[model samples]
Target chain A: MEIIKIENLSKSYSSLKRKNNVLALDNVSLSVERGKIFGLLGQNGAGKTTLVKILLGLTHPTEGRFSLFGDSTNNYKNKKRIGYLPENHRFPNFLTAYQVLYYLGLLSELNYDGLKRKIFEALELVGLKGVEKKKVKTFSKGMMQRLGIAQAIIHNPDLIFLDEPTDGIDPIGRKEIRDILVRLKNENKTIFLNSHILSEVELITDNVAILHQGKLIKQGSISDLTAIENEYRITTDSELDTFLSKSDFVNFQLKKLNGFTYVLSGTDEDGLNKFVDLLRLNGITIKELIKQKLSLEEIFISLIKDLDKVK
Target chain B: MRNIFIIILYTLRELFARKLFIAFGIISTLAIGIIWMILANGSVMINQFGNANPGYDEMEKIVLGFEVSAILFLSDLFILIAIFSCANLISSMLEKGTIDVFLSKPISRTQLLVGKYLGGVTFVFINMTYLVVGIFLVVSFYFNLWSFTVLLAIPVITFTFALLNIFLIISGLLTRGSALGMIVTYFYFIVLSPILAARDSISNFISSDILKQFLDFLYYLLPQVHDIVKTVFKQILLQNENVQYELLIYSTIFLIAGLAISFFIFEKKDL
Candidate 1:
């Protein structure tokens, strides 16, 4: 089921000193499916925050329509099922971690009867079990981030929006948060993750969308986005140097690497087969041949650099 | 309703955490203590004024005058303090990104703003009541003047504060900072309102009818805080039934319009 559906969403901010409205989100459209971790990848000023704000009703959309839980109105009822952990989020400094969760949980309309238990559960889930009594002012960045996550999930919301969830978190804490997010996904809850942390998103997200300059340039399953077309990495027991010296292989391009490893690029799958056959014909014993794919970080950097070039 | 209540509680907690609530409480207690000490020696103080044995009516009048003076002074002090303390009520939430959390909850922007506004009013009301009722009891016990009319100042002062707080809230929302709101509120309360209240007398010196009409417009357009306090003082001291209901109605309308404007701006504003 589509937990969130946004169509032609655009937002522009007006300023007294500027001649033109600053476009924050430009004709962006996307949907989040239930029981999946959907990652929204963007650089700074890419309107990632604006998109989240619009969904959470923190701001009005200048154009387009969006629905939450299949309701186009985006009323308060839909918010009951939605949870948001905004970047740089702050709770009242004087409030203890327990109090922060309790307050937000009450705002979420959770009854006081079992709220204490929920607070404890959420704290423990975020690895903040015993520190619930400590005031937020004394908490470190990681602890505050954990508390933020605890507050976001204290109501057991069906759809959670986490912006830069691992920001300011140590690697170990980041891994723990990833674990909690995966656990939530396993519970059939949809998670819409807005993050610049490509490696973190690469680890857990089922689907990813790349946004650049307020425009969604690419979006799809992670596998499809990262897979290199008609490319394979092959390792053989013998090098193909002698074969390369005599043959004019115009159908494919081959580059030899360290030892017997070679990167082969072809026009299609049939071309890959022909290359494999040609290598085998030359008595190059094939030890391994695997399809190649780019890391998410590499893909993100490449996409952003490509866009920058176009600009 | 529940969400608004929770936000109110949250706002109160913020005030308590900031120590402003405790500060207001302590100040009220000190005022009460001072008033008790003064009223306990009411007879001796009157004797020093050449009145050896004042009648009950004279004593009531003297005590009522003193009560009115003290309340007026204390209400001004409390309003100034309250304005400064609650100035950051909305702005801090925006600066720290807490308002986003509140807006994301199952509550409308109206509920969030109303809850915060009521929270500020409730803070000021609690302190005003403490000080006013304390003085009322002290005077009632010492002078035997059970004047129920004195209690009216509690709501009147609170109403004035509620109106000023609307300005603070509007400024806070506009700039996302407390300094400008605090300054504008203090300016309006201390300088602008008093000057505008004297428009009729000040108009005599002004030759231009347009300028005089502009002064009248400002007096009527803004909250008539000075006039309201004057009316309240007359009612408390003279037992006057000739109340200016129009002033209250106009101020109430301003309050409603201010709140509606805040909600409209906040709802559409990009956080």
Candidate 2:
């Protein structure tokens, strides 16, 4: 089931004195499904956070429509099932970790009887079980981020929105949070995350949408977005540098990566098969022939660079 | 309702942790201690004043007069300190981005704002009650005269602060800082409201009727803080036979209208 649906959502910010308004989101639309991790990728000020805020009702869309859990109205009851950890979020500095979670849990309308256990469980999941009594002012940035996450999931929300959840976290903590998100997804919860860490998003997200300057430029599953067409990284037992120097290789584009590995590109699968046949006939035993793929960061940078060049 | 109550508790906890609440508590204790010391030395006080053998009625009047002065002084001080301390209740949340967590909750924007408004009012009320009741208890114990009239200052003073708090909250929302709210609220209470309340005497020197009418309009439009405090004082001294209950009613209406304005601003705010 579609957990969140937004269509033609746009947001513009204007000051009375400023003649030109800032378009934060322009005709953005996307949906998150149940039990999947959907990542929103963007550079700073690319309207990723604006979109999340609009969906969570922290801000209203200037134009278009959105629905949460199939209900489009401004019913606050939908928020009970949703959790959000905003970028740069802060809990009351004087509150202990436990107190912060307890209060936020109560705000989510959790019964007081079970809130204590849930707080503990959330703390443990975020690896903050021991410092539940320490005031937030004394916590490190990473610790505060953990407490933020704990509060986000303390009520066991069905849909969680985390903007830069792994921000300020160490590599180990990031991995732990990624595991927690996966576990939540396993329990059939939807996760909508906005992140600048492309590698982390590439690793855990089932699908991703990239925004550029208030516009969505690319969006799809990781494999689909990164898959290079009609390209293969072929590894062989025999050297290809000397062989390619002598062979007629006009049927495809080939670049020798090293001793026995070459990047082979062609117009179609037939062209790829012809190159494979030529390699077999030459007694070059094929060891690996895998489709080439780009890293998410590479695609993101290229897309952004390409757009910048067009402007 | 549950969410609003939780925010209130959260706000109270925040006030406690900030140590301002404790600071007010300590000040109240000292004030109460001073009152006790003064009332306990009634004979010595009268002797020092050259009235060594005062009758029971004279002593009671003197003590009640002293008590009234102290209560008024403390009440004024309470309103000032309360306004200063509660000014940042909402602005700090916005500055630190903690309001996003609140606005994302299952509560409406109106509920969140009301919770914050009440939380600040409750914080001031608790401190005012502590100080006022402490003074009343000490004075009543010394004189063996139970005057319930002075206890009424708690709600009256708190109500006055509650009305001013709307200005603070609105300013906090608009400016995203406490300084503007603090300055505006203090300016209104200490300068503008008092000047407008005494406009009738000032009007004699002014020739322009339009300016006087504008002043009168302001007096009627604003929360009648000066007038309400004056009426409460008269009632406490038992000098007011015809209590201006209309002042309280007007202030109450201003409070509701101010709250509605706050809700309107907050509901449409992007954050």
Candidate 3:
């Protein structure tokens, strides 16, 4: 079942000094299925945060409609089911870690015993078990981020929107957060993961959506979009500088290091054979040859760069 | 109703955790101490003044000093506390992004506004209760003019005025800068109303009686300075003089109107 559906959504802001109408989200449409971790990948100023805010009903869209669990954005019932952790999350500084979660539990309408158990469970889940009484003001950056996650999941929400969940976290903390997200996802929770960290998204997200310049440029299952054909790079020992001058391959680029390496992109068997034969005929012995697929980061950067060039 | 209780609890917990509550407590204590000292000293001076008259009633003299001192101290303390406590109530929360977390919940904007307003009012109640008790002891035990009804009504009136003023300031704070909103509110209640009430005859040379009456009307529209202190003064010192029902009605109206405006503004605010 489609848990979230946004149709033709747009958002803009206005002010006196300048009518700065930022097209934060531009007629964007998408839907997420139940029990799938959907990654929203974007660079800075790419409308990812805006779309999340609109879905959470923090900010109203200029046009179009969105619904959560088949209920409209304005519906309170839908809001009750959704949990959101905003970017650079900040809690009331004076509240202790336990107090923050307890407050959220109250807002979520949990009973006293239920709230207490849930708060403990959430704090333990986020690895903040013993310091529940510590004030949020004295917490470090990573601890604050964990507290943000704890509050977001305190009600055991069915759908969670985590914006840059590991933005400021160190590698160890980041791994812990990733583990928590995977655990939640395995429990059949629908998670909307928004971040510029492509690798983190690539690890846990079942599907991915790439947003660029306030528009959804591409979106599909991780395999569908990033599955490029296997390609080989062959580096020769001798200085075959003449290969750069000849344009035998259509989608091939060559570079000379200690020798020469021809990097071919397509998976044409005949073309590979012909190129190998030609290199042998030139008396160039291949030193190293490796076949590899493009990483998600490489694909993401190339796609966004291409989009930038188009604009 | 559950949401209201939750919000109130949340707000109270958050407020108590902050340093401002501690500061308010210390300030209220010092204020009560000051009031105690003045009443003690003023009673001595009043006795001296009565010594010359020879026929002056001792009870009447002591009651007059207690009434004057309690009225002045209560009004000033309540106004100061109201201004300082609520100056950044809404704007500071909005700035710190705590408001966003609350907004994302199932609670309505109006409930959040009311919760915050009542939270500040609760703090005022606690502070005023201490002051009321302190004043009651000094007036009744020292000056021999304390009444139970006056003790109860003094804090109630002060708290009512504080709520009205805090809500009004919060209404403005939601839309504009906190400092600017607070300054505008303080000037209107503290300076403008009193200046208009005095009606200085010199103003008659340049303005008509209609304009003067209009100014008086505006002054009355405000929560009066005297009303805040009258409960303690009337019962403790003025003997059986009761607080006017009309002032209570006016206070209720102001409190309701102030909260209504705050709710309206907060609903539209982009926090």
Candidate 4:
């Protein structure tokens, strides 16, 4: 089921210094399904934050519409089921970690009795159990980020919006965060994550959307987006040229490397079968043959670079 | 309603965390102790039977004037502190990426605004109550004079503070710069408020009818807190007085209007 639906959403900012309206989000539209980790990948100022703001009702759209959990952004009750952990978040410094959680949870409308254990559990979940009495001001950047996650999940909302969640976190902490996210997913929760960490998104996202310059360039399942077409890298004990020499294999155009392997692209399934059969006929043992796929980072950089060149 | 209380609680926690609440309590206690010591010393001197200390009635009149003005000054100091402390109430929240966590909640902008606002007011009220009650008790017990004037002054000062809070909250929402907020709040309290407070005197000094008309309009528009202070003291000392209901009514309207405008602007704010 579609948990979030946005139709041609746009946001513009106007100021005295710049008379021209700054288009933050330009006619963007997409939908996120329930029980999936949906990643919105974009660079800074790519309108990822702007789109999140509109969805969260922090700002109004100049045009188009969006709905969360079957309710329009205009209906504020939808927010009751949503949680957000914004980038570079800071809690009130004077409050102890426990007090910070208690106060924010109270705003989330969680009663004290209900939030009491949840608060401690969240702290422990985030690896901050023993330091609950310490003031937030004394926390390190990574600890603050963990506390941010704790507050975000403290109310146990069905949908969570995390913007640059792993920023400032160490590798181990990032792994812990990923584990917690997977657990949340297992419980049928939907996560709408906005991040520029392509590798992180590549690791966990079931569905991915790439946004650039306030426009969405691509959206699909991660596998489909990164799938390489008609391309395979094969490793064998004997090179392909040793079998064909200068014969009818001239049209094959195979690229050889390290005297034992070859990369082949633009070959159909039948051609692949014929090539494998030809190798077997020659008594060359095939070590490995695998389809080559682009990494999200590679795809993302090339996409933006290509768009820049096109303009 | 529950949300409002929650916000208020959050505000108190924020203040307490900053240690400002503790500072307020400690300072107020010290001030009360000093007054008690001074008055008790005077009592000791008079009880020695040959000292030059004034009698009970004279001491009462003298204390009425000195203590009243001193309390007024202390109240003014608290108002200034409240303005400085609470000035960033809205702007700070709207800043530092912290606003996102709040805006995504199931609460309205009005709730956040009112919650932070009332939090500052409640903090100030607690300190004010402590100071006012302590002074009342110290003066009555030591000098053998109990004046209800100090008690009556709490509401008047508090209502006057309500009027200033509008400016504080507005500055918090409108100007993201703390220095700018401070400047705007103090400008109103020091120059505009006093000008409006003594509008009648300023009008008499002005020769031009048009200028006098402008002064009159401003006087009626702004809160006449000076009038509140003067009347409260005069009534306490049983002096001849002219009490005007218009000051209280107009100040209340000003407070309500300022708060309403702040809530409206904040509700539509982008972040």
TM-scores, all candidates, are 0.93, 0.93, 0.81, 0.90
Q: What docking class should model 3 receive?
A: acceptable
Candidate 2 residue B139 Cα shift, in angstroms, is: 1.7
Q: DockQ of every model listed?
A: 0.70, 0.69, 0.38, 0.64
Model 3, B148-223: lDDT tens digits are 5545545555555564565455645456556766776677666764565465553666468888777667656765
RMSD of each: 2.6, 2.8, 5.8, 3.6
Docking class of 1: medium
Can you write out model 2's per-residue Cα lDDT over B1-271, one digit (the tens) per residue? 7777877887888788889789999999999998888767766876875788878777666666676778778878888998888899889867546888887779888888888889998998899889888998898887777767777777888888999999999998888899999999999999999899899999999999999999999988899998888755657566568777877888789999999888888888897
The reply for model 4, stretches above 4 Å from the true place, is: A236-239, A242-254, A257-261, A269-287, B41-70, B143-149, B232-242
lDDT of 2 at A177: 94
Model 2, span A1-311: residue lDDT tens? 99988899889999898899999999988888899999999999999988988887888889999999999996888898989998999887778898888888888899989889999999999999899999889999999999888888888889999999999999999999999999999999999999999999999999999999899898899999999998889899987776455446665677889878889876478777777787788888999999999999999999999999999
lDDT of 4 by residue, B158-203 (tens): 7767677777788777765566777877887877877877777887
Residue-level lDDT tens digits of model 4 in A1-311 = 99999999988999889979999888999999999999999889999988988898888899999888888746666777888998888787778899888888888888878788999999999999899999888999899999999998998889999999999999999999999998999889999999998999999999999888889999999999898887778899865776445354555556776667787776777888888898898898999998878999999999999999999
Top DockQ model: 1
Regions of candidate 2 where Cα sits further than 4 Å from its true position: A239-250, A270-285, B43-66, B236-239
Candidate 1 collision pairs: none
Give the per-residue lDDT digits (tens) of candidate 1, residues A1-311: 99999999999999899999999999999998999999999999999999999998888899999998889987877888989999999888899999999989998989999999999999999999899889889999999889889888889899999999999999999999999999999999999999998988999999999988899999999999999998888899987776555455666677887798888776578777777787778777899998889999999999899888988
Worst 10 residues of 1 chain B by lDDT: B231-240
Chain B TM-score for each model? 0.94, 0.92, 0.76, 0.86
Candidate that would win on lDDT: 1
How many backbone clashes does every candidate have?
0, 0, 0, 0
